[model samples]
Each structure stands twice: as structure tokens, then as C-alpha cells.
Target: MTCFAIARDDLTSPDVLDLLRLHLDEMHSWSPACKVHALPPEKLRAPDVTFYALRDGDRLAAVGALKVLGEGRGELKSMRAAPDYRGRGAGRALLEHLIAEARTRGLIWLGLETGRTVPFLPALRLYESHGFAESTGFGDYVPDEFSLCMELHL
Candidate 1:
């Protein structure tokens, strides 16, 4: 079974920290330094952001966060499933949890920024399967070749 919770200490746990590092490294490798927007663990701790961890037994399977952008909108941030947990539904579970949370919070739109490169194809497919469609940039972001924006209107 999959279990998820609002991560408090998990964000600081070694396993989770390692996953975050891997995520950031992958982002930077795929996009230019200025276009890499994955937030660090400390940044995910902001009051407007809600972070979560997905666990399987005693293992940390995945991590994701939602940052509240005012005006009935929210942004997905730092979503990553450990390599060992890929194909085990961890990423999908985390995405579903965030989507449900957004709906419950009265957010009318949920958006995300991800790489436009081949390495990001899997993630792009996942979001698209979950009803997210490609969209123009929003919030503090501007349209950039290295980044692709997607949104799901609730």
C-alpha cells in the first residue's frame, strides 16, 4: 500500500535529501542553470508551500510539494520519485495527492514547470495523462525554450 503525509522531518531525512539532490542535479543537467527551477528542501519549507512524502513500508518512495500562488492558483514543485520506486506508482500517487489537495483548498488552477528536453518526457507524459495540458507561462515565469509549462484547471 502507498502512504503519504505532510512531511516534517522527512524533508530533512537522508534518503529524502538525497532524492532532492538527484532531482536538482537532473534538472540542471537538462536545462540551463538560469532555467532550472526545482526548489531546494529549504525553499520548500516556505509557509505558502505544502510538502509531502510518499512512503512504502519504511522506505521513502517519493516527494512533492505544492506552492500556493494567490488568486486561486497553485504550482507543483520538486516532484521526484526515487529511482528504485519508479514504475511503482509513487509519482502518480504524489501527483494525485497534490491535485486533490489543490481542489480541497479551492485552487482553480494547478500548474507546473518542467524541462522541455528528452529526459523530461516521462514526467510530461505523466502530467498529461493526469489531465494537465500544455500552457503558456504563468506567475513569475516567462516562456522559455528550455522550460515547458502545463496547467490543469479545476
Candidate 2:
């Protein structure tokens, strides 16, 4: 499979928004606990929230972000690969890229909230495979029955 680097401009491009919406809606259908709360693309213009979109040829294949929450802590948000793009290593690439970016910025730890529901096993496994371990809640996120918190030490 031919995989290309994700370009910065594509992150908020109108063309890629549909791909992101599809991925997010799929998550909602599959796991209610895995909700995306980023204020729409309009509000994502801030410097603290960095978003990326990976493309395969002209097709948008995956997307992810690093949201700086201050105090050397960051949150991983909107990590998703198009349905047809799964298993092609795009997801893994985006994740590893984001993690390395976070480390480069001097973050001590990176955290994420995913579903504890039945449908999220694959996502949980991906995070664990990448060295993220179970962790206590950070940020405004609380310990909810339907969610699980995971973190990686840099």
C-alpha cells in the first residue's frame, strides 16, 4: 500500500471534513462513550489544538490531533481512519506521528479517553500496543462507567 504523509492544510480543508464526520459518526454508532467534543472546524483554529489529515493519493485516509491542555499535559482527540482505510497502517502512522510530536513539545505524558463499551476493543488494543497503559482521569474528564483512560509517559 502506498501511504503518504499527512499535510497540515488538509486537516481543516472542506474536502476532508466529510471523511472526518463519517469516522466520528461511526464511533457514535459503535460506542456512545467515544464522543468528539471539539468545537467545530471554525473553533479549531487555535494554536493549542493541532490537527492532521493523512491522505492516500487524493483520498483522505486518516485524521488525529494533539490538544495542549497546559501543565505539560495533552489530550489525543479525533483519531480515526476511514472505514476502507483501516488495517493499512494509516491509523498507526497517524498515532505514532502525533505521539512523537507531543514528545517533541516536551510533554511529560499524553492521555486519551476511549470507550469501555463492547465495540471499542480494537481501539483499546491499538493504544495498548503503542505503549499506553491504564491511567487515572486527567483534564476535565472524570471516571465514567462507560469510558477508560489511558496514558503514555514520555
Candidate 3:
């Protein structure tokens, strides 16, 4: 994680909560409330999900999560880099950490649901660069104009 420390977070830190609130607020601004699927802090604390936080010294750098969706599949969620950490390696470091963690957990496939719109282009590109390919919706997700589903066969 370079200069950043990455760890399994309990989602209770004020910084983590602030980031999640910012994430949800950003999602709502980009899409309708119903189309925004970003999970809240309480939901991210579910047993099936593991939340990670990256920190530079005592400052929050980024946050991300992985959810075991059964049958050797995992889902990425709540990926967000702090405003100060944007354009830095923080986001990539956290993403790489999560991907590696997913593999370590014996996940055969990693997938995610994200918005399909201008605000989400950078995120889409990042996932694509990491080998996530556009795919049909999974789990309870439905294909819609506001949604984009992607997967990577591990």
C-alpha cells in the first residue's frame, strides 16, 4: 500500500463515515435516488461484506469494499478516494488491494454494479483497465439506463 495503510475497517470511524456520506451524496447527484445503489455505512457492515480503508498517516486516503455473493463470486462496492487523494495512487492502491484480497478469498469472479453516465466514466475506465468487462446484471440488479454491470473472471 506504499505510504498508505490498508486495513479491514469497521465502518465506524468518522473519516470513513464522512467518505461514505460523500459517496452517497455524489451518487444521488449523478443519478436518481432509486438508481443509486451505493450502500450506506450500516449496510457495509453486514457480515458478508468487508470494508477497507486506506490511510496516509492519520488521514483517510480512500475506501472500498468487497462482498461475498456466494458461489465463488464477489462484488466490489463503495469505492471512493478522498478529494485530496484524487489523481494520486491512493485509489489504485486500494483497488489493487481489494482485487488481491478477493483472489485470496478464493473468489472465481469479481463483479460490480455502477452508474452508467458521464460522472461514472472515470470509474468505468479504471475498472476496465483492471480487467473488468461489461457484463449482464447479476444478483438482484436489473439492467436499466442508469446502471452498468461489469465482471472479471478470476
Query: What are the TM-scores, per candidate, against the unseen true structure?
Result: 0.93, 0.86, 0.96
lDDT of 3 at 116: 90
lDDT of 1 at 17: 91
- Give candidate 2 regions above 4 Å deviation: 31-39
Best by TM-score: 3
- The best-first sequence of candidates by lDDT reads 3, 1, 2
List candidate 3 stretches off by more than 4 Å: none
**In candidate 1, which residue pairs get closer than 3 Å at backbone N, Cα or C atoms, i.e. clash?**
none
Alpha-carbon RMSD, candidate 3: 1.3
**Candidate 2 residue-wise lDDT, 22-99, digit = tens:** 766766676553343434554455688888888888887888888898889898887888878887888888899989
RMSD of 2: 2.2
Instruction: Specify the poorest-scoring 10-residue window by lDDT in model 3.
Output: 136-145
On lDDT, the candidate that comes out on top is: 3
- Cα RMSD of all models vs. native, in order, equals 1.8, 2.2, 1.3
Prediction 3 global C-alpha lDDT: 0.92
